[model samples]
Target: MISSIIRTMITEFNNDVDKLSNDLTAQSRNHVITPREANR
Candidate 1:
């Protein structure tokens, strides 16, 4: 049971990271972040 719970948590964390990466990629593709802001 503990192992299953840990696996589930890891899967959720991975999914969250993937989603955040996708969001950042989309924002970058849209040119939403300025170069100066990025440098900061």
Candidate 2:
């Protein structure tokens, strides 16, 4: 049971990272949302 919970958590984490990566890629391609601006 514990292993299953951990696996589910990892899957969700990976999904979140994937979404963030796609968003960053889109922003970079658009050349409007820079890292510096996002840091602010």
Say which candidate scores most in lDDT: 2
User: Which regions in candidate 1 have their CA more than 4 angstroms from the true location?
Assistant: 34-40
Give the per-residue lDDT of model 1 (tens digit) for 1-40: 9999999999999999889777776776779975445444
Per-candidate count of clashing residue pairs (backbone under 3 Å): 0, 0
Q: Give a tens-digit lDDT track for model 2, residues 1-40.
A: 9999999999999999889877877886788788665444
Q: Highest TM-score among the candidates is held by which one?
A: 1
Worst 10 residues of 1 by lDDT: 31-40
Model 2, global lDDT: 0.82
Question: Each prediction's Cα RMSD?
Answer: 3.0, 2.5
| Distance from true location, Cα of 29 in model 1, Å | 0.1
Give model 1's TM-score versus the native structure.
0.79
Q: Per-prediction TM-score, please?
A: 0.79, 0.78
User: Model 2, residue 14: displacement in angstroms?
Assistant: 0.2
